[model samples]
Target: MGPVRAWRDEEEIELGPRQQRAVLAALLLNNGIRLSNDQLIGMVWDDPTPSAVMALRTYVYKIRKTLPELNLKSRDGGYTVRAEIVDDCRGEPLEGLRSAYFDAQRVRLGDSRLKAREDCLERELDVLELQKHVAAFPLRERPRALLMRALYLEGRQGEALDHFHQVRALLIEELGLEPGPELRKVHAQILNGDLTLPRRPEQLVPDLIDFTGRAEEIAQALRTLPGTVGITGMRGSGKTVLATRIGHLVKGRFPDGQIFVRGRDVANELLRAVGVENPVGDKAALWREKARGKRFLVVVDDVQDAATVRDLATPGSAMILTSVRRLHELPGVTWLKIAGLTEREAREFLRKAFGPVRADAEPEQAEVLLERLSRLPHPIRVIGGKLSSRPGWTIEMALLQMERESRLADVIPSDCAAMMAPLIAAEKQLSEPERRMLMCFARQDAEVIDSRKAAEMSGADAGEIELVLESLAGVHLIEPLVLGRYRLPRFVRFCFGLRTAELTS
Candidate 1:
């Protein structure tokens, strides 16, 4: 009952397009039951199109033409499918499709899959087997709760409690929600030492879907697996997104469970997750003791210092750290510097993300729009999502409108805008001189700033300007270049340029 597919006599029958298959799935999941055109439309589309009924009929016609063996019938002003639903997979049911009906069905079908796994694991009573099983369904909370209970009962209480923290972090990271009552209940029982035996883990839930680009970076990182990885980039360069997507893909290598930790308290979170409740004495040693010999992954987001997370990467595991600026090295840590998408990659991203851009662009017109957005994924997603939803808006039209707006933020729909969280965080952490230096650099309309010119503009000496530029570069607000110059990213200029005007006007 996962995803919409038709199989006759063990050989899979071709289901037409996604919407057509959804229509079939609705009928079959409710087999022997009929649904009206309106009901099917409601189930099929998140926001139904105007000619939904006619389109549904066309899909039904295609389905009938494709599979003539089935007794799919039209009656009572509706259609009904008369076949049993059957399927299997270790993925979110209807994994890629998004709709309210699919969301409801995903929850229902996911619970059933969870129950089936629980029954089978209960029969075997093997923790090792359960660990492997959980690796396939990492986002399923109930099974993870079951796994935690089993670990605690097997005298691995520290590992069990550590998993509880991992679950808590994972839940917060993915869904932006706290653990549900059932999971919290199991955790409480574990902490109180009243846990009973039970079983299950996989996929890191990713924020970026059908992600494009970063092939070389992903391949290089994957090649050097089971070691610390540092993915550093400018604030808007998609550092965390790339890390999480890559982390989700390579989860099977670590069966002990992949832990995602963010914020300043990395050491404490790791220490707790590794089951050293109060490792007040020799905390690093206790952390090493707990994390040692366990094959797992630890992803620390927005990290500042390398030393803070260096020791957490014990043997037999991997770590992926995402930060705005380049970090100091840890032993065996492979570093990847994530820059903006190449022009070709940017064009492909725009074409894949928004179809209007798929139409031929006049030479350099699309580049104008990309220059404003800096070819960064965050800004692209922001403007690209708005453009994708409105097919009538061509790249030329968008560029014209963007020029009309006083600021990039003005043209972008408030609802569709990128969070710009990383940018704001980086701004808040800036020192006074760094802030002024950034403002001085941002105020100029030029793409690149000469050091001598920046010093002249800021009325600072050569030495002071150099230090300020170095500080700005350290925080990644400005990038250094050949010949004592710096390049300010277009998106950053679009953002702070307006602020610079307001401050200096």
Candidate 2:
């Protein structure tokens, strides 16, 4: 059934089968465009003979007569569907509602990388309810994808995985074609937790032109006395961005000396043997060697596990450790948490990215550009990159084809290697109970949950769960929200979630 509605304050009219079919064909073909009599005739009926023209007029007359009843209009010699007749909410512009509608759909579809899974699942349920009730509406590929994503995000993992497999199988059996790599990747990402915390390289480089905002936060972290300062945030929220930016900003302050090693390499040295037939005493050995030389400013990014991060920070050395998990053990470790970008900041970024191309021609293009970019810096960067070559794309057209032409992940890197080290660390430190707790949250939709609730969900006690959360938190695999709450950053969440699910499932 198509989703359609008629307007109030107009005569009520019902269309016969032929008239409904003809009008639907015309509306779909013209879609916000003007269509002439001949164009309408051709779209409605393949070829109109002398009588065919008359037959076209008969159908057109029926549609036209029904329009007043439905408040539709044939303006400028072309039929235009009236928004009033759509039965959608009033006062609010249809475009605004449509944008919200699609955004809700985007989240529901789990394509909205910015929002957490819990939020997306809620939206998916709302959209599914709408889908069951709406009538006389144009169908689209988007709504179908939205449903699939909703199911996937709703923690219906087996069902979601099966549906994607079924889609792949059907595409092969019916269309004799393979699903596109992007679709396959999305399916894999959702099942494997890749979509939750896909990587972005721009987050790592502080000097990059794209790194805007977070200056104040970074400055404050750098100004935190002389003790060990730790920067933590949700994945893709810019912990490393702030840390790297602070390092560059304060490099002059620490001109005497600086030492930096990423957590992964640091952990490798700490965990394994160094010389043949001899075990590496502790990973801290290397850091002890490096800091022994001089006064240095040490910056370790993605410092997973407390032991690994602690090795790099000598008492005298100025050190900064960036991680998604919470590190409370480092006696003087000052914590700085990064939050999401404000709507205004995200909008301003889109304007800057798309402003140049639409400078003279269209003032409205900026709004269109902003809408398409969805206020995410990484995706906005990609949109800007694509528009750099073709300065002529009207904002509307560009946005409409945004998802159709490319998956959002394609614009952003998928490896997220810097973010994955914590998971590796967490895996290394896992105890039987901790492993069970981590796997429980890893497979669920919520990024973070209360410890009591998590323990309840996992059939464990608070004391038992705290040890796991703390252990995971120690290595930067998960972060503590307040007293009992903990959250997973997308990066570590993605890798470990997959591993956790694979192991437990």
Candidate 3:
């Protein structure tokens, strides 16, 4: 439970310890269903102990004594809290839980009998409460849809349509997504003054088949409403995919439309989305004027300068920007820096990209392959695509080839070369001393480098080294770590080392 206390009539019953609270929560969540001793132990402790079952039994005893009204019974080699007890619960069900999943369950249980019951007003009040809970999760659509249906059934068509528009705008402004067919159909029906409208044909771009992981990042970006959220990561770290996925997720909110454009063509794309053909006046001014009243999700990807970010970020619209470099100059934009996938996420990605049969069959080989790819999603997907397309190729063969290749360019997909080229060019544009500092980082064996040590290696003053490090960090070539230390990705360091070696040779 959230604050960890139970109630019996007007008296507050104490539930001891966090583990005890967890036990109560697990039992309450599965109120009518028996949870086995092992399941309860697992729920209480991330790593269950042999004594965990005894501890669980003790907790159950305490709970039983505290709230005798709750008919907590042991049956079928497990425990269950009866549904009747839950029904009689006076205060909120799982009041202190505060978890979105628990809140959603509460809403589901509340509305479960709505169709069978004749209490329309009660159902309406439930919908209102559910809406309040759901407001925290802007990316979710089902609850909003339910609210629309409830309002429509109550003959409040105007309010239903208003709700639709509000959610639609929120979706656009927050996620750069459009309403799904179900919501669209409801809107159409409301507009036509008819209770029933045939489901509108779905209009959507095909989702990335190899897309995996970053669910949390996507959710965070979605939650940043009415403000710019920037996604920055190393090249090919899936920043664009994340931004695009977010755009699709929230597209329904922006009923006006979603405009996705590269850094160079933001002005053109905004104009195009707003249906401005061959505008004569200042494009930026015209874009702001046109976008002032409309709800649009503006995605500016591969941003090369602060000017593009400033130009596309209109006052009324929501913006999502993706770039290899950080947009430090832009104020009020929340930045989320993506990194390589965890080993688990990488393994799952491999399983998804390559057929699970092959990927799972050779687990050791899959591990080796993920290591070779550095757990970067783009490289994993690329290699997975290659292995999948050629049935004769095995994970072992791919791993062997990756090990033998002297250069990352040789091991990775050919397209990765193009992706790295811009970054290399950016590095080339740096001053001689700055380039030397980066080269020193490549030569070092340590994972992190500080300005003092970098200066010693590069034969530059510590002051100059610090300034160059900040510049490199701004462009996302290096990551600033704790206490002014900097870390370069293994792949980037390797590439720089190879380039340095080639130049000297």
Pick by lDDT: which candidate is best? 1
TM-score leaderboard ranking: 1, 3, 2
Error of 1 at 501 (Å): 2.9
lDDT of 1 by residue, 103-136 (tens): 8988888777767667556545567877887788
Badly placed stretches (over 4 Å) of model 3 are 1-206, 389-392, 407-435, 443-446, 501-505
- Which portions of model 1 show Cα errors greater than 4 Å? 1-203, 274-279, 329-331, 356-364, 407-421
Give lDDT tens digits, candidate 2, residues 135-171.
2221322333444555666666676567667667766
Tell me the spans in candidate 2 whose CA falls farther than 4 Å from its real position. 1-206, 267-286, 289-293, 356-376, 402-505
Give per-residue CA lDDT, model 3, range 355-435, as digits (tens). 999999899988876765557787677778888888998998876654443344323335444434544666766788767
Top of the candidates by TM-score: 1
2 versus 3: better TM-score goes to = 3
What's the CA error at residue 360 for candidate 2, in Å?
Answer: 11
The pairs that clash in candidate 1 are 134-201, 135-201, 137-202, 138-202
Q: Which prediction has more favorable lDDT, 1 or 2?
A: 1
